[model samples]
Target chain A: MSALRRVVRAFPSLLRVGLAEMVAYRAEVIVWILTSTLPLVMLAVWDRVAQDGAVQGFGQGDFARYFAVALVVRQLTGTWVVWELNQQIRTGSLSAALLKPTHPLAWFAAESLATMPIRAVVLIPLIAVIALWRPEMGVGFEPANAPAFVLSVLLAFGVHFLVQTIFGCLAFWLDQSLGLFNVWFAVWALFSGYIAPIALMPDGLRAAVEWLPFRALLGIPVEIGAGLATGPAVWSGLLVQLSWLASCAVLAAFVWRRGVLRYGAVGA
Target chain B: MSGRAFRAILAQWRAAWMAALQYRSNFLADTLVTALWVGWTIVPLWFVFHRAPERLAGWSYDESLLVTGFFMMLQGVLEALIEPNLRGLVEHVRHGTLDFVLLKPVDSQVLVSFGRVVPAKAMLSVGGLVVVLVGIARLPVAPDLGALLVAPVLLMAGLAALYGLWLLVVSTSFWFVRVDNLSYLLTSILDAGRWPMGLYRPALRAILTFVVPVGIMTTWPALALRGLMRPTDVAVSLTIAATMLVTSRLVWRRAVASYTSASS
Candidate 1:
């Protein structure tokens, strides 16, 4: 209870620091954002493929919309927390963080959240230009879906951060959790619709991936924001996101607790 | 190409080999990572092909695998050699560690380029070859012998161009100080290499073939394997490799000359 209160009390300062840090590294952040433009590449290939005809109900415009929104979702949710955590843990600089009055994860979470306002500032104008030019992607921006889309993106971000925290916690036991995270990343890239829309997946694969956290963390917001999902689908998607957000939060806390006990600060 | 340079490079490899041998257990983990990555490489093709009822941009699924295999080989080469060396060069520049290299009595470029070797990454290249062979086996006709011969040479041209590109990017760190993620833009281009060049729009195809030449680097080799390449492309690729290598060398020298040490 006290830890929770302390984190809440400290969050404004933590967020200010995070936002300042992100702003200082703004150029790097933009470059980092641009580096994940694999979806746009996939968008090109798929757009070309769809030019032949709509394949699995996706026309060129649909792909443009899906990928554009997917890019937004990725930029919003992605954080370097795993690398930050893994480095700190491996180098034992995590001890410096451990000495803080509040939990370290709170600061990490603050940093992740801090990237948003700046990213949005960058994203909004791009979104405007893209929407103005290719207005087909302008779907689901209606007030009806806006709140749901917002919530889904936030939950997705939560799930993604917590998942990364869990993986970063693996560094407590494994020598290079980054390798393990690479495996996770590759799988995530496929299942998360980063490479291609999960809608286009074969039925069996889609069925299987639906239960996984990857899609919940990435695809649902894209789907919602792109208007691929309707009223019932939106509610169900939010429910799934909430469940994932809750479960991953628990899992991350559990992993951290267990992992921190094993922290002998080998580097220290 | 000289005997002493060859021996010096050989010694670097020997040290790399012994260092890898010292951590034998990492072999299993490295192999596992390679296996998973290879799966990531192949699985996306399945999804894209599943949607395409017929050939995807004039290439069959089996045929596309050839491109994927070639792409993987280039990727392995990047991960194994170019990325590590150039990334090290960036750090060396940032921290002024290049002074040691400048002091060394050899071609600074050659030493920096070939100094680091990740022997464990050999598995990724081997994995790529296995996929290429598999794709070859599934082909309607055997890949022609002449084509096979040209494939490796073309692949070297591709690799040389990529290495040149990386060197050029590293050279920019002399001014930019932190251009780390800039290299990933090249990587994103390489990621697009998995698909057949025909799959890209004409403008993109032209860009990939002429401007960036990722098509030449990855796709041309696969096309050569299937006896689909124009003889003219081979010349173009070689020209590109030579141009890139020469240009990168000129740029690197200029950058080196202008370099004020970042550290005292």
Candidate 2:
């Protein structure tokens, strides 16, 4: 309750700083958005492949909708805080955060949230393009599913942020967490549908990826957005997401406390 | 032209080496990171071959491995030399540190291009070479000595092409200081080079080979390993690399001449 109160108190300042930083990096943000055209390239390739015959369950139109939604979903759920936190901890700049009254997680969350407004600007055009190019492909924003979808997105963000923080905290124990982060990212890229849909994976791998948290982080929201999943699958996926979120949140908080202690002892 | 310039270059290299030594642990981590990246490339081939153990895009699994191995080697070289040095050009240009670099008696371009040598990345390059050698040994049709000879030449051309591309991007900082993220754009495009260019659509293949020229950096060396290089492809790749290098040099000179530091 006290942590929540502190976050509430510091939220405005955090948002202000985040917005300023976002504005300062506006050109970079634009370039980042533009550089996310990999999904579009994949979409083109898959669509061509499905031009003559469907690949498994995906037709050309399905490929278009899948990749387009995947792109948007990736943008929404992306968390690069691991890189920031790792750099800060390694350089001992995280001490600055420890001195703050508010929890560091609150500050990071605020910064991540602040970037959403700018992201919405990029997302709007992408939505327009999707609407124009593939209007028939939507999963339908049903009233019942809307709340669940929103909840899933939030839970996904929680998992992503917490996992990144865990990796960041590894810097206290290890010399550099970048290699671990790279390995994790490679797993995420392959299993999380960042490169391709988990559904498109070979049966055994698809089954394995489905059980993993990576798919819950990226693919589920995409699947929800595409209206490909519903009912029990949605609830079960949400349950899994929440479970992972809770576990990661606990792990991150625990590791962070210990890591900070170590940093203090080492006088870095 | 002067002995002083040579001394300055050597001094810079020594300084970079000493700095890298201070964080020796990071060297191991970076090497592991490169190894993981190399592993990432091989996984896709494993899956592709598991599905159909013959070939992809008209090349056997071993050939694909050759492509990936050569690309990794070339990428290691770029990261070791050009990337670490010129990556900071935007920050230097923004902060007016370029003036200090310019005031030196040495050729600024050469200095800027080789200012920092990432020791960890040099290790990664050695790793990439080992991967290439192992891959060659496993090939059904053994590569001849000529292929091995041409490999380094092609790799050098590829590295020059990449450095030229990066220099062009870095020079944009003179006009737009916010283009630091342009390196991210370059890396993402290079990621596409991990696969054979033949797998892409004709238009995309053309763009990757000619416009981006990533195919020349990665695929040509792999093709050489397979003894598939026609004289025409070799000539075109060399021409492209040379053209890009000259063009980037011209652009760099012009950008520097026109640069009015942000501090002013």
Candidate 3:
């Protein structure tokens, strides 16, 4: 009860700091969104190819819609905290967070959540563009699926955040955790449907990717948004997402415990 | 004039090298990061080959690997020298550090252009070149001595063109304080340079050559490696690089002239 009370008390201050940092780096955020334009470019190229004939299951319109949805999903879910956490842990500035009464994960979560307003502003326009420009690709706003999609997004964010925090915790052991983070990101890019849909991948690779947690991170939400999966599939994907989220949470907490014990506060 | 510039250049290089050695582990970590990144890039190609097992845009899988390898090399060089140095322009302008750069006796452009060398980035480029050589050995066509000799020259020209393009982007910081995002805008466009330009529609191919010139930095070199370049393309690429370098220099001067320090 006391721990819950402490979190409630610290929430306001945490948010204030997160907002300040976000505003200070507003230009960078804007640049990051603009730079994530690869999907759009790919969309153009793939749409052209699909004009000749459908490539696999995707027609010209489907390609346009899929990749356009990819742009929005990628932007909304992306996090750079692996780099930030690695830097803080390596430099021993993580001690500052440790000194605070609140849980460090809470602080991390707050900081990530604080950036949502700005991202929302960016996403709204993109959602509008997708809706207005690509009408054919629009999923009917089924009330039942809305709850599932929302749940999936929350789970996606949780899985992604926890996984990154785990990577960040590696800085305590290794001198540089960002390298591991890079490899993770490359894998995420390929398996999470950032590069292309898993459906388009070769049979063997696609099968392998399905068994992994990466698809639940970005791909499932995208697929959900496109109305590609429904009913039992959505539930099963969410179950997998929740399982990964739980595992990552456990692993991150375990690493953090060990990492903090060894923490010398050297760089700080 | 040349003597002073030469000394200044050597001093900067020494400083950068020393700074790199201090962070040796970070250097190796970054190199590992680059290798993993290169591997990630290859995965898509691997998948593509698995799907078709045939030539994409008239180039075999091995030939495509050559293109990927060369493109990676060009990218490695950019990340090493130009990208890292110019990346800080926005922060420098915002914080008025541009004034300190201006106060130096050395040319501010040269100082800014050659400021930092991420040692890992150099290693990445070398790793990429190794990949290119490996790909060449696997190819059905054996590149002769002439082609091998021309490779470095073409790579140099590609580097020059890349530097010129980045300078143009960094110079925009003078006008737009938020130009870092614009730099990313450029990067997103450059990502398309990974694939051969011929794979793109003609319209995109034309735009890449004329407007962005990423094609020259990546695709043309790959073509040269495959022994597909005509003398005309080579001459045009070299001319373009020279023209871009001069234009970038002029732009930097003008931008610097308009620089009102952030402190003011």
Candidate 4:
């Protein structure tokens, strides 16, 4: 309880520092932001493929909508915590953070949140463009779906952060957890709908990916944004997302507790 | 190309080799990472082909895989040689170590480009070669001997073009100081090159061909392997490579001249 209180108290200052740090490296951030444009590349490929005829019910317009939504969801929910944590662990600078009364994960969460302003700058314009020009893509500001979309996006961010935290904690046991993170990223790129719509997957692959946390991180929020998810489906998907988030959070905390013990023994 | 410079470069490679040998376990891990990277890139193409009832943008499934294979080879070259060297450039500029590099008797560009090698990353290119061979075997017809001979030359041209592009991107670090993510912009472009160039819109196709030349770097190699490339196409690719090489050299010289050492 006291740790939680301390974190809450420290969050604003951490957020201020994070935002300053992000701005100080704004040139790098701008370059990093372009990495998310891969979906735009996929969009081009799929859009052309669908130009002649629909593929499994996705026409050019559907692909346009799917990839645009993917761009938005991806920008919002992307996590670099694994990389950050892995670096800190490897350098043993994590001890400096360990000395704080507030948890290091809480600081990481704050830094992740700080990047939102810049992300929103890019996202809002995209929302405007989609709303004004390509309304048929169904990405316009619809009031009914707005609440559900917001909730799903939040859960998606949480699930992504917690999952990365769990993986980052693997550094406690491995020489280079970043390698494992790369492996995870490769799998996630396929299953998380970063490359394409999960609905477009073959039934067997789709069935397997749906149960994994990756889908909830990207696919579910994107589906909601496209207005393809609704009512009971929305509620059920949120439940699944929340469940994944809870489990990952628990695993992250458990791993951190054990990992910190190992860190202390190794370093001190 | 002088003997002393060549010997100096060889000595650096020896040092890099010893360093790599000391951390040889990283090779196994790097091999797995390379496989995963290849798989991640290809799976989307597999899904697209599996779900579509017809061919994609006039290319068959196997033809596209050939493009993917070529793209993987380019990525291997990037990861193994280009990215590491360019990253060293960024570190040099940031930490003011470019002074030491400037003091050396050999050409600074050659030293910056080929001085360090991650010997373990040989696995990535080896894996890429395996994929290329597999893609060749899966093709409907064997390539003509002449076309096979031209393919590797064109691939070297492609590598030259990419190195030029990377130089242009990394040269910005002289001014920007902390643009580490700049390499990833090139990477994202390479990612786009994994697909057949014909799949893009005409404007984008033109951009990829003329501006970035990713189309030539990847698609032309695959086309050559399939015995489908024209003589004019090879000429154009070589010209593009030469143009990029000269342009990047000029830009790199100017960028270096503008450098004032870091504040610290």
Q: What docking grade does candidate 4 earn?
A: medium
Angstrom error of the Cα, residue B186, model 1: value is 2.7
Best-matching candidate per TM-score: 1
Best by lDDT: 1
Pick by lDDT: 2 or 4, better one: 4
Best first by DockQ, ranked: 4, 1, 3, 2
Give lDDT tens digits, candidate 3, residues A154-202. Answer: 8888888888888888888885878668677778878888767778888
Candidate lDDT scores, in order, read: 0.85, 0.77, 0.77, 0.83
Residue by residue across B1-264, what tens digits does model 4's lDDT show? 678779998998898888767776776666666666666667888988887645777688888888887887887888778889999999999999898888889888888887877766656666667777888887888888897898899889999999999988888889887666877877887778989998887888899988888899889988899888999999999999999999999999999899897744
Candidate 2 wrongly placed segments (more than 4 Å): A9-17, A35-38, A41-52, A87-101, A124-147, A171-179, A200-211, A259-268, B1-33, B48-56, B130-152, B224-229, B258-264
Model 2, A88-141: lDDT tens digits are 777778888888889887888888878887887888887677567666555344
Per-residue lDDT of candidate 1, residues B84-203 (tens digit): 888889999989989998888778898888888887676778788889899999988898889989999999998898888889988999999898888877787678888889887687
Q: Tens digits of per-residue lDDT for model 3 on B153-259?
A: 77788778778888988898889876766766787788787777766768878888867888777777777777888888888888988988999999999999999
User: Tens-digit lDDT track for model 1 on A1-268?
Assistant: 9989999999999999999999999988877776777876788778778877888778777887888888889889978889998999888999989999989989998998898887787777766654664576554344577789889998898898988999999999984589878778888998988888888998999999999988887889988888888789999999999998899989988999999999978667
TM-score pick, better of 2 and 4 = 4
Give the C-alpha interface root-mean-square deviation per candidate: 1.4, 3.3, 3.0, 1.2
> Candidate 4, A58: how far from true, in Å?
1.5
lDDT of 1 at B118: 82
Worst 10 residues of 2 chain B by lDDT: B47-56
Model 3 RMSD vs true structure: 4.2
Q: How do the residues A108-186 of candidate 4 rate in per-residue lDDT, one tens digit apiece?
A: 9999999988887767776576445446665332457778888999999998898888889888888368867777777
Q: Give per-candidate clash totals.
A: 0, 0, 1, 0
